[model samples]
Target: MKILIADDDPSSILYLQDMLGEWGYEVEVAVDGNAAAEILRRSDGPLLAILDSMMPGMDGIDVCRGIRQSDTERYVYMIILTSRVESEFIVAAMNAGADDFISKPFNDEEMRVRVRAGRRIVELGEQLRRRASRDALTNIYNRGAIIEILEKELSRQGRSQHAVSILFCDVDNFKAINDTHGHLAGDEVLRVLARRMAATLRPYDSFGRYGGEEMLGVFPDCGLEGALEVAERMRAAVAEAPVKTEFGDIDVTVSIGLATVDKDQTCKLATLLQRADDALYRAKANGKNCITIAH
Candidate 1:
């Protein structure tokens, strides 16, 4: 993990930089609080930051407050560095969203422990984020994450005008499977199909569990023709093999509905999703196991 050191004092920056480097951390340096704030706002920036309390502009507390106001999805653990360890100052820094604090002329041992703790906290936050975004049953992205992915794709398409496609997939006769075997067996079938179909996707493509017995696939920079090929592979993945569960072996087939936004067109996320869903309805109406495209 990378750590950012933001301070104006040359001697203080050099001392802290050397100390942190010795502890095996990749260090990023900023001469002013404004520079530090820019780095902290980046999505790929370091998770841990040490800010000087009295930088010339945009002081440590102000920077921390600024970062807290941005997206709270991916957390940045911030520590305020100050020469004074007064109770009043510490209280003010904590209120501004500083995760930890270190006083100037700081003890080397204390700094080491705090840095270690900061990394652990950042990792824990990431784990919690993953847990919240993933579906509990199939281990794919949950419904909310799928919608988020769709929105992001639409935004990117508007900028680049590159082709994007989506697939709406539903398991055929899923409720019948539950009635015949058991709910546990049906769950196993969903998990198996999710893993199988996901294995066939390109590196940039994403597959998610949209809801019960339904899945969504997002394809970036892919046209209708390319998406059709990918959708066929996903359909075959489910039909080729029987899912083995505690109850029994069950045969499964998946129906896919594909929608594409060509490179020349820009559309809303809702419109794209609605087209795919309508195509899915057509696929179901045509036959149980098949693929249909929304023109």
Candidate 2:
């Protein structure tokens, strides 16, 4: 785990850094509020922070306020280092989004306990976020989370006028599978297809379960040709394998609708998604296991 110590006092910095390091933590340092705030607000910043209450400017309270107000999805657990014991001071710290507090000149044992508590809370928060963002069945991004990712990626690509490709995929004969084998078996097929198709995708591509037996893929900086190639690979990955379930080996295949936004083409997110969906519907109409591209 990483901990950030934001204090202008050299002695305090050295003391915390040395102690935290001894306790198996990587320590990051910032001498002033601006630097501290920048680190804490960054997406990959340390989630555990200890801020001195009386820094030169924009003290710990201000830092907490700024972080809480920022549009970052990362959660930061902040502890305000203060000597004050007044009720008003505690209220102020809590209102500013400090998770906990440690009095200045704190006892060594007290610091260790409080730090561990903060780390546990951070871990719990992360677990909760993962549960909320992931699909319960397939362990892929849930519908809302996947759509959010696609929007963010598209917005990022739009800024650079880079190509963005997407795929809308659905299981072929999924209803028939559920009627013949149990729904549990159908679920197993979905899981198996998700795992295989995900393995075949490029590292940067995003694959998620949009809904039952339907999946969505977002490919940033990938063109139409690349997207179609991936679609074909995904199709083959499912058609070539039999998913082993409690019932038995079950044959499965998928149909895909591939769409792309060229650097020169500008379109709304809904339009692109609908284009892919339309293509996917056409692919299913033409044949069960096939890929179709949207012009």
Candidate of highest lDDT: 1
Error of 2 at 101 (Å): 1.8
Extract clashing residue pairs from model 1.
none
Local accuracy by lDDT, each model:
0.92, 0.91
Number of clashing residue pairs, candidate 2: 0
Give the per-residue lDDT digits (tens) of candidate 1, residues 64-150: 999998864679999998898889989988998999999877899999999899999999999999899999999999999988988
TM-score of each: 0.77, 0.83
Measured on C-alpha atoms, candidate 2 has an lDDT of 0.91
TM-score of 2: 0.83
Looking at candidate 1, the ten consecutive residues that score lowest on lDDT are: 65-74
- Model 1 scores a TM of 0.77
* Poorest 10 consecutive residues by lDDT, candidate 2: 152-161
What is the per-residue lDDT of model 2 for residues 52-91, given as tens digits with 9 covering 90 to 100? 9888768999999999999888799999998898989999
